[model samples]
Target: MSDHPILFLPGPTEVDAELREIMARPLIGHRSAGFVDDVQQVCQRLKWLYQTSQHAVFESAPATALMEAAFRNLVRPGGRTLHLVCGAFSERWSKIATDCGRKPELLTVPWGMAHDAASLRQKLASSPTFEAVCITHNETSTGVIEPLQELAAVVRDASPSTLILADVVTSLAGAPLNFDAFGLDLAFAGTQKCLALPPGIATYALSHRALERARSIEGRGYLLDFVRAVPETEAGKTLATPCVPLLWALRAQLDRIATEGLARRFARHIAMQHETLAFMHQWQIEPFVADSAARSPTISCLKASGRDVRQLAENATKAGYKIDQGYGDLKGKTFRIGHMGDHTVARLQKMLAALLR
Candidate 1:
């Protein structure tokens, strides 16, 4: 295991040794009583992590699967979905809606800018036919954090019938998200980023509104259908066979997170964000998201200026550290540094020092 390089880019951030050990434990039957008990316990912790009392379910697939599930289960055929697009992930949600046969309208801002709540309100007022609103709480591609609570409030007032679906794949554990209080219909996050686990499991909290919406939508697929999962969940099990190893890892990781306390965990991420940004400013390299208020504390996307960011990442990797040169269209123009999960200030400082050299 020592031969494997540590991950620092984003999603699959470094997992702690203790959690890894849990993943290597003996396999258990998915339908066994022990497994059912384990799932229930993990679901409870997930609710606490999301800061919601809503029903939380674990998906065996990655975060993208849950995103698709949200679109499929919430939006009926020929229904309309309004997607707030500012980065790659948000754009993906628009595509997902289209693929699900729903007509999707995009309210777009530039890559680095946030989709302001007022602008969303304006769009909602003009287009009241939308069945749902999809927002990426944190865009991993651009390191932008949307104002989830404010946007939710606007959507609630503008169209009470339109369900609000948020993707918090990269932001959940590292930041604060109140699913129920914010009036969100559904919110999903993968375990890899802030949960400090592997990449197989994605957890989601579903409000009663989302479930009611699903009840009205016909032809909702079986695997991801929330309507199906909710009934099986009541029996303390998944509708399908879940990844047992990932669940073990998730249980262990959630225990570790609970031990650290959510506020302190969020603070640690903020500290790393500030430390990395401060170091980048010394080199005259500004962050991709110009407004600090819109920046993500878990992931920092740094504009490369005139520097060859790809080459910088290659060099940094050779120095026993792993990093990313942004994503999609921003690949060469920006570089990203992730400080979520078990990453520490000293570790981030060392990577920054190496890059600054």
Candidate 2:
């Protein structure tokens, strides 16, 4: 209606106008007391969003930087890690571990498939004991959603000490991820997706056990180290310069999130997913993830069916809809529909209508 193409890519999703205005506010000194208060409040809201009573981490970098932080802190050098790979993003976790000098064994499932707790338990039973188990809560590349609570339960039962580090980049705030309830050691997210903010700021949560592990682990480095971040955070200070404007925007966004309530927010994402799926079904297009239980509520990766997906994407773009053209090897074979951030069911319906035309 505004003559602007609606964004339906995974992330960074469209930011609300209010958030954009907030971001445009005048910059402030990161070391000022006011900035410190802003960061502290942002961390508290992040903890509530993560549903964790542990350390709420703040990094002036993107979520990719924190991925390195998670591996460095939780897995120590040469530590064995069990990586559950289902899609492009999840697969990157293993590479990160390898690059970080950790021994990572991957239990790879085909794209569009999910790993349940029982399956993970079986995998762990046969595999060597791992210091950390890494997983992606939502696989944006394939639109597959792994059941983290169930998987964490299996880890807890099989290897109680094994740290669970979840890549929640695409799932956080879009879905309900109770970090403490799921017994996860650490989980982190970028603000661009579900948080509906611009990129460049990442929030992370680490459990008490994870902090202890980080303290004992060496070669963790300076910039992304959790050990240094925790004490500074506890003291209401930052270890380095932070993105103050983004923090301001994040605080404003968090307030809106609180007003909407996480439950309602999750329901909004679910409704959008169903609406898109219903449209996809009526159109007779195949879903990338055949299993409904494994489908991501935030991002829907649909099979291109026989249509030229590249042309379809071009058509959609010309028609004022910014949809996806898939990712990696699946590019041009699948198309994704992102339903997260500050988006609503009504907005998606309007966009779908434009694409259908």
Candidate 3:
């Protein structure tokens, strides 16, 4: 029916038709009263979604930009930050920190595995005081969801002063993350994933402690300066012109999420996860992540089981679907099915049925 196949990759999930229409409406001035009100409302809703009382703000950039901003704002030059690397996204954060000219120490587990709290505790004990600890809540490439709540507790007990920075790009909205309750200093995500919106914007929640840290850190750049964004964000304005259409689409999507209720939305995602697992079993393929506890409810990575994953993806595209063959080093060895955002169990069942055919 359409030239472009429906997306079932890890990110840039399918958008609702209603939201597309909303984005197409006439543009609005970023500084106008109506736009300001929209910005305020969106932030408030985001706090509800993140389950945090901390300050939430957005920038006209991708999630990686926010990752770099976190390093610039929280870690001083030559200050050490610990990165927990288990997959591509987590490894990317460490590189971003190094690119910022900060000292980063990495604690890596094998790919397709979760970082253990015990190992993290031991690592923190052996290392000097860190300025921050970077974690990827959900590894999109590996389809692993680390035990964030437990890991945060380990950080609190072992290194109370260290800021806990989380990249929740593929986990937000589709997973259970209570920022303030879990004691996170910073959590960031791109809307193109679970928020069911288009790319080009990223949102983050910053605690009071993080703001204080940003105030103390020098050389924080102009565009992504966390300290500079506060005053304007508090007054319901952005530092510069934002992608206005995405905000309009975001507001509408938030309303849809509100109607569904956060708990229900999370339950829906879990259901999709189970459905996908059943589909995997039917095909006699196993999940990449062996531990059921660590498997992501948003994306499922399955071992190829002697199948041609690249050709499978090509067939899927020809059949009007776009599926992930794998990511980075795992390509052709494993494939991923993104079941987050507005996708439901019924919809996933239909897709799985088609694949079966």
Each candidate's number of clashing pairs is 0, 0, 0
Q: Residues 118-144, candidate 2: write the lDDT tens digits.
A: 778888899878999999999989999
lDDT for position 52 in model 2: 84
Q: Over the stretch 146-179, how does candidate 3's per-residue lDDT look in tens digits?
A: 9999999999889999999999999899999999
Ten-residue segment with the worst summed lDDT in candidate 3? 348-357
What does the lDDT read for residue 278 in candidate 3?
A: 85
Q: Each prediction's TM-score against the native?
A: 0.97, 0.97, 0.98
Scored by CA lDDT, what does every candidate get? 0.88, 0.88, 0.90
Candidates by TM-score, descending order:
3, 2, 1
Candidate 2 ranges with C-alpha deviation above 4 Å: none
Which number leads on lDDT?
3
Q: Which stretches of candidate 3 lie over 4 Å from their true place?
A: 1-4
